[model samples]
Target: MTMSRRAFVKTSAAASLSVIAASAKAAAYPTRPITLIVPYGAGGPTDTIGRIIAEGLREALNGTIVVENVAGASGTIGVTKFYRSPNDGYTLCLGNWPTFVLNGAIFKAPYDVTKDFEPIGRVVTDPQIIISRPDLPANNLKELIAWFKSNGDKATQATGGTGSTSHVAGILFQHKTDTQFAFVPYRQGVGAAMVDLIAGRVDTMFSVAANAIPHLKSGAVKAYAVTAKERLGIMPDIPTVDEAGLPGFYTANWHALFAPKGTPKPILEALNAALVTALANPDIRKRMEDVGQTLPPKEQQTPQALTQLLKDDIATWWPVVKEAGIKNE
Candidate 1:
């Protein structure tokens, strides 16, 4: 028997509704524990932040949350694990700048960032500081630029890795000022970089204010300028790169939240809500500030905003990557 056009259409609509109902039912979500994939070694900044966020999420969602560190290949190995996980609310990933953006662009990856994961919201945005050994003759950004131009690539700068955010910040500094320096890639953490900076082994370095602040206070290192649109409230005396002669020089290290692609809409919304609530807690805000980070506004902290930011970063860094002659390490 042949079905009439109206009957056929009605049947198709019913089938679609049934599928939606089934999906919504399946999306009741998190009957079990959730795993937060932290793509870094234990005790690292990413892992620390991931655990904090996981705790907050667990309290809010009323389910156990675990932060799993799957470190290797500069975080790609862990990130790959997250991207390939089941696209349920049970699996999320902790991601930060350069690792989430520049790393994927510069290194071979098993999963495509845009296609394999769903962005939830940004966790924090930390400003990077251009610091020098306390004994350096250059006192600030202008003096440092002049010194580099005069010295001509004789100065050295240290970073955790070649394509890290710290390294990119240094690259942007040279690109803006039209100078060059010997880029020293350190296998160790910022602690080693701090040691070298103190001993004057490196002439300059780009690192987060959190890592540099203690030393800045101890007289071991001097901060030249911060790569932020404005001076940090904690260090208002310090000028931004914009105020220091490069009018538009700005960069920041940022962390973001993500779920494997195909996670339910309700789950994503719930995660975003929990993130916003967490950011409002006075304790969380203070802790983030202590680490040189600030919470972005709620309106600009969503998945859509992250997508645009990622796209803009791709545009912003592609030229810098090419101009700096950077390659995978």
Candidate 2:
């Protein structure tokens, strides 16, 4: 005897419920240690931030979170590793700005930022510093622009890498100033270039506040202007690059967490919650702020917000990248 239509529908519903239950069970996340991939060296800003978050995640998840450094090809090497990893929520990445965003524009990558991974949350943001060697006459953005015009290619600007955030900010500065200065890209980190700048090898460079703050305080280097729209609380005396001159020149870099695509939603939510807890701790905020960074608001700590941010950033940077004619090294 054939089953009636109602009986067939009931059987289908029961089977669907069983599949959902099995999936939920299989998503039993953090059954083992989770790998947090930091695509930079151990002590850099991105890696530092990743470690802090990983520490906090350990407390929240009650599971070991290992930070694996895979620094090469300007951070693309480790990112590629995560893209190829199993999407079982055990592997995630600390994707940070300038390198993450600008690199996407500069090179043809195996994984597109939009399509390849799932955003967990943004961690923090730090302003780029426009610091100069002590001997430069320019103390502000306008004066610095004028100096560049007069000096031309005689003066050099250094950056961590060709397509790094600081490099892009310098390119933006050049466009706004209508002047040209030789750009020097360093394979080593930006701090290495600080030595060159201090020695007068290069006139100036844009560095993250963490790298530049110590130099500024020690008078080793002079901060001409900051790319933050408002003066940082840590160094309020220094004017914004816009306040100094050239309106609407705000730029800063951020650190975001992402999981390999296809991580189960439950695991993603659990990870997001852990991140939110980590970033929300007052002590964590203080530690981050002491390093010249600020945690993103809780509202901005979601996969959806990160997805929109990536889209907006892609729109914002593609034109700039094209205009600058930036390409893979």
Candidate 3:
């Protein structure tokens, strides 16, 4: 069928207009401030990393990125908020292992870990350090274990609530050493827990190296060992769990960025590119490294890498957490 000249012109103009609208939408993304949700309280390791990344993102995008701390339920509460947010790429969450991978195994969280978010990229990974109050009288892991055995449940372990990394670390410590400690739950996050530990209200904790470093250096807490296969460069004086006589014990915490699922691909790519640029900055790298964060190699800083890590961690840790019968309180 042959179209009339007026009808053909109208159809061509409509098609051209559609293409321009799509291009305009892409070019005008992030027209307003973006919110990056942090699933823990302020001053915690996740919060620290989130702030750093948010600053870098602000610089990269030449736009505002604000970090909002929504702490509770071992980070599930905040993550649930992120899940429910609009998938317009204006909202994101800086999530780590416990919130993104382990919470679903231990609690009936409202969102599914694998299905609820779009991975942006991973930021950093840090090992946990076994730290205790200065007056604990256990200078090393062996002494600490023996002390726990002698004291029974008299010694208290501070945790950032149920299903948190600290909580799981405490459980694993008990299982490995065949000992127990009275657990004290702190809903706010490690900052609150660390405060109590420093004040001698709690006897011990397994904390992220970056979180524990200041206390360790200030003589408020004593570091026994790191929860990695090898010693961290930032704290070479500290021994590994294996070296500290816990032969097979290892744990590491990592942080990554994610947006609500169904965010447009162009926005995801833009966010990721900004993240990669920020991570590669020398000042950023040095600051993160000084705080015991081991940035992933350039090859492993992509969205695919973060997605695979979430999958692998879920497969590896869910069974163990289930068998241990851990649950939210």
The Cα local distance difference test for each model comes to 0.79, 0.82, 0.90
- The candidate with the higher TM-score, 1 or 2, is 2
Candidate rank order under lDDT: 3, 2, 1
**Residue-wise lDDT of candidate 3 within 219-247, one digit each (tens)?**
88999999989898977999998899998
Best by lDDT: 3
lDDT, residue 140, model 2: 76
What ranking emerges by TM-score with the best candidate at the front?
Answer: 3, 2, 1
TM-score per model over all chains: 0.83, 0.88, 0.93
lDDT of 3 at 201: 90
Candidate 2 stretches with Cα past 4 Å from truth are 1-28, 198-200
lDDT of 1 by residue, 1-329 (tens): 99999999999999989779756754565679888888766754566567777777777677789888887656677788887899878888888887778776677788876567888999888788889888989977888889998887488888767677778778777777899888887654455667888898988888776677667777888888888888988778889888887777777878899988887777788888888777777777777776677789888778899988888887777677876777786
Alpha carbon lDDT at 169, candidate 3: 88
Q: Model 1, residue 311: what's the lDDT?
A: 80
**What's the residue-level lDDT of 284 in candidate 2?**
74
